[model samples]
Target: MVSIIFVDESFRSGRVCWIKDIVVAVTAENMEAMRSIIQRYRHKRISLAEAGATRHRSIFNGLKALAEDQPDVVIIHDAVRPFVEEDILLRVVTAAKEHGAAGAIRPLVSTVISPSADGCLEHSLDRAKHRASEMPQAFLFDVIYKAYQQCSDYDFEFGTECLQLALKYSHTKAKLVEGPPDLWKVTYKRDLLAARSVIKEKISQEICVVMNTKDEESAGHLLKEVLKKELNCVNVTSTVLDHTGGNVQKFPTDQCYSFICVNVVSSEFQETQKFLSTLEESGLPLLYPVVVVLVHCCDLTLAPLASKMESLMWIRSLAEDMKKRNVLLSGLLLNYSKDEQKLQESFQQGASIIAALVKERSSALAGQLLLA
Candidate 1:
């Protein structure tokens, strides 16, 4: 099933304060699975409605189930299209409240042609003059519910478009609003791959760098600056992890999936352990694989390379343990230097590695260590 992220932006306007509920219509065979998945979001009011054989029936049933709630507006969306933005939803709902109905539309990509009875093309439509209807449609609750109540059996069995029902039965012409390119639906095997790639790209765009307050001018801060240059398009944020890990608690709530814990003051993994504990306590990793790159920066002149590596070798076992909880833990050892040029070179190398680990998010390198 496609996972949809619902962001409530309705607080910005008085028309819609919050999403009252989310109704998912699914087949009987998939009802248990859907319920199991929906249970994860205890904070949201989500329920499942029994789906019918036809698409129109499924939608009508969903709307009928919500009639008792007497909501001001109803937003209908396809579960297959998970990339719908919050702004599009808000616009549709606001427009529906004013115009009685509203839906998203995109410019037709190819010319839609009419075929004759003999299966040959009879005529072609002007693609520039027509638009492709998309999901995230909205309507005034009474208008859509009454339309479904009055629709015929033939329409319920064969009809696919809900906007047409509102126009034909309720006399409500739906307002067509333009949508973005990412509103495409997942329909094929290749589309699943594309959706996964898009999701990974979206989650990797933000990185949170956690370090101790004592290392403000240390290699950790330098690496943070270099990372900003390496991943120019990504949002890089740095937070100080105090003894209580108070400041580091906000990253998970901010939906930051990538993290780099810079341990510059100690050879042991005390800072990294504290950071991981905070993340575990939040239970954010249970939803998605959290990319955690533990960076140990030290000046090799003061410590032997063998002893330093042996001290941190325990991270490999810890990484394996964290991976069980959906946390992708990896280690980076950066040889800190006193020379200006040497330090900059080392930080650049570490920055590139961190960027790759965050972007790919491969499980294969979960317990491995990379040296720079």
Candidate 2:
């Protein structure tokens, strides 16, 4: 599939002239994977040299190679504006592919004036006619590469503008897009504060892991403990359909299903026993079939949990909960870890289990899992 090319240029320009570095990074090929990696380490600053490539040549070459072989829609951007939104990228690239040239621009804040001798301004142009060209400039591979292919060192080194290059050589008139306020470049120290604020707002929305907890003798602390190290897992007292909206995106399913429960806590596990009991007593709609994993740790001796109280304390408790006929158990898991990677496996196991159950009982995997 043709994907958007994320272009990031790091240059010590404008007021911050003390730094001496001009880097152009082009991320393409398996765009989603690259993006996921970026989001995973958003706070971390990654350098091209660490990836085994030193210069901007390697970065540009990597992008060019991917472009020639893959032939995908490319969106070139500047690292000065680190707070670029995905919507703007999508809009610009989508238009660029259709029109051959598309670039984002903002209103000129200061008047462009020319100074002759002293520190006095001589001439100034109408700010209305001119606009401050910003990042997130997008163009098709053939259109952009062609411009770079037939260019000089000035165009590659001193000439840092992407949109101007495309227009200067290819005679391609760029579709100047009015960018959002967040598109402002991080030129001065004040711009960095603005960037930080924008980034903070972007991450304010929490990623919630909603699970059902009906344990009577449990305070819902241990489960939260395991998840606290990885994610924000909130255990709902029951399946409350009234709780809607907020980041409530779900997988395709017809029924209302919430919660990931582990029924096979050893007999001594009060949380497991009471949770099953509470689930049986709670009267809720089974909008979607739920995912339940029967888990028991192998490393730690869980024989005390399973055999100390009774041979079938955990199994009978789940069976009793099943009698409620509220929701269906979709999947089963024997063991799991609190590790981040292991958490994904557990989620997948539960998702697959719910997918099968939904398919068997209802519309089947129609809206089972929620998108992050």
Per-residue CA lDDT of candidate 2, range 135-251, in tens? 777777677777777767655655657777789877777888888987876889898877665543333222122333434422122333443444333222222111222222322
Please give each candidate's TM-score: 0.90, 0.46
lDDT of 1 by residue, 249-333 (tens): 6554457899898873344466567768788878777667889988888887888988877777878888998888888998888
Candidate 2 global CA lDDT score: 0.48
Displacement of residue 158 (Cα, Å) in model 2 is 1.2
Q: Which candidate is the best by TM-score?
A: 1
RMSD of every prediction? 4.4, 17.0
**Which consecutive 10 residues in model 1 have the weakest lDDT in total?**
1-10
Query: In model 2, which regions exceed 4 Å deviation?
Result: 1-59, 206-372
Deviating ranges (above 4 Å) for candidate 1: 1-17, 41-43, 214-216, 243-252, 264-267, 301-304
